[model samples]
Target: MRRIMLLLILYSSKASFSYWSRQMNGIRVSGWLVSCSYSHFTTSCH
Candidate 1:
């Protein structure tokens, strides 16, 4: 019983960690793209 509970806990934690990491990666990529585009726009304007 205890082993099963431990396995469940580990599985849940791993799943949550993966989900959060994916979300963070997506945010980071979008932020990078926005920054790149903004810089390009400014340089072109000048």
Candidate 2:
């Protein structure tokens, strides 16, 4: 029982870490898109 519980904890921690990594990647891509869009807008305006 104790071993099962330890395994569960380790698995959950890794799952959460992967989830956070994916979220970070999404945020980085969105930020880059936003900057590119802003630059395009300014260039078009001028």
Off by over 4 Å in 1: 1-11, 44-46
| lDDT (Cα, tens digit) per residue for candidate 2, span 1-46 | 9999999999999989989999999999999888888988777522
TM-score of 1: 0.60
Top-TM-score structure, candidate number: 1
- Total backbone clashes of candidate 2, pairs 3 or more residues apart or in separate chains: 0
Would you list the C-alpha lDDT of every candidate in the order shown?
0.89, 0.88
In model 1, which residue pairs have backbone atoms overlapping below 3 Å? none
Clashes of each: 0, 0
CA deviation > 4 Å runs, candidate 2: 1-11, 43-46
Give the alpha carbon lDDT tens digit for every residue of 4-39 in model 1. Answer: 999999999998998999999999999988888898
CA lDDT of 36 in candidate 1? 82
